[model samples]
Target: MAATDDFSKDNILGEGWTGTVYKGVLPDGSILAVKQLWRSSQSGKGLQAKMETLGRVKYW
Candidate 1:
């Protein structure tokens, strides 16, 4: 299987050391960006830790 044409370079939104970000439209016309993360970078502060930190943030 392959990704849709919507995931091509023409729809590129931005990029980072982790992955290339792409802008995509669903069949329902909703817009969204897809991120492809690098497997080697999923350590250190993981998702649960990040979420816990975010949960502690006090908004003004």
Candidate 2:
């Protein structure tokens, strides 16, 4: 859990049809917006595929 603590109600920044966004701070003090996707919204394989696609995009 990268958040100031575990993803608690106090850390929730917003919610949407896709998932919930939480405010997080890394160990080095870098701020981050963390999104927790709903399990029912996408299958594990589908998520893996999307992550792979994003990895490829990063190389461009």
Candidate 3:
């Protein structure tokens, strides 16, 4: 779907402390939003900690 190129200043929908969202349009004119999470390379949160946090996420 070429999502990388689809996200641009013109497609920005919104943003927050965790990440930014971009609106994407399809060939058929359908619209969708992409949320790219914000993570720091130097957050000091180790792999174990990250895994633990993810494990706690309740996805229904």
Candidate 4:
């Protein structure tokens, strides 16, 4: 099953805070949700904030 097989509009499942999730069909016909992240401009400070958030999650 390849990732490309499941990326069609017809299989969309849901959306969330960050992006829309689509139900993808693998080459073998397995189902999976692929989250598409919305594009945003990230400044240095913003990137640092994200890194801090990730670190916190890792520690938690």
Candidate 5:
């Protein structure tokens, strides 16, 4: 998908080696953090680690 201007620097919430995270407000008035993954790090092992970490999370 194409990123719009609305999700620009002004809407960025944080940034790291992984990617830049943006704060977005949905139509239901819910706020969400959208993490734009780094293309270079989109490997199978990284994805597996992410899944494992998510599975190990006991709470939000």
Candidate 6:
């Protein structure tokens, strides 16, 4: 994705049990963070629900 420049290694911000976090930028020049979730049995709708429940998260 353009946001993460195809998830380039240089853009990696951090990693966690669930996935890796990447630094991203939007076309408007807004900076954001994205998480690339690890593959698991829980995917598609199941994964969507899990993410929705998370709402906004803060991690250092």
Best by lDDT: 6
Worst 10 residues of 2 by lDDT: 51-60
For residue 26, model 5's alpha carbon misses the true position, in angstroms, by: 0.4
Candidate 2: list runs displaced more than 4 Å.
Answer: 40-60
- The per-prediction tally of clashing pairs is 0, 0, 0, 2, 0, 0
Model 3 TM-score on a 0 to 1 scale: 0.53
Candidate 6 structure quality by residue, lDDT tens digits, 1-60: 899999999999998777899999999988888889887776689778868875666655
The lowest-lDDT stretch of 10 consecutive residues in candidate 6 is 51-60
What are the runs in model 3 whose C-alpha is more than 4 Å off?
1-4, 40-60
Please provide, for model 2 over 1-60, each residue's C-alpha lDDT reduced to its tens digit, 9 standing for 90 to 100: 846478888999898766787989888877776778775667789778866864565311
TM-score of each: 0.59, 0.60, 0.53, 0.47, 0.61, 0.68
Clashes of 5: 0
**By summed lDDT, which 10 consecutive residues of candidate 4 come out lowest?**
51-60
Candidate 3 accuracy as lDDT? 0.65
Please, what are the lDDT tens digits per residue for candidate 4 over residues 1-60? 146344566656776555566766667866555666667566679767855774564311
Candidate 1 Cα outliers beyond 4 Å, as residue runs: 1-6, 47-60
Regions of candidate 5 where Cα sits further than 4 Å from its true position: 1-5, 51-60
- Please rank every candidate by TM-score, starting with the best: 6, 5, 2, 1, 3, 4
Put the candidates in lDDT order, highest first. Answer: 6, 2, 5, 3, 1, 4
Reference-based TM-score, model 1: 0.59
Every model: Cα RMSD to truth? 6.1, 4.3, 5.9, 6.4, 4.0, 3.4
Candidate 6: where is the Cα deviation over 4 Å? 41-54, 57-60
TM-score winner among the candidates? Answer: 6
Error of 6 at 32 (Å): 0.6
Clashing residue pairs for model 2: none
C-alpha-based local distance difference test score of model 4: 0.60
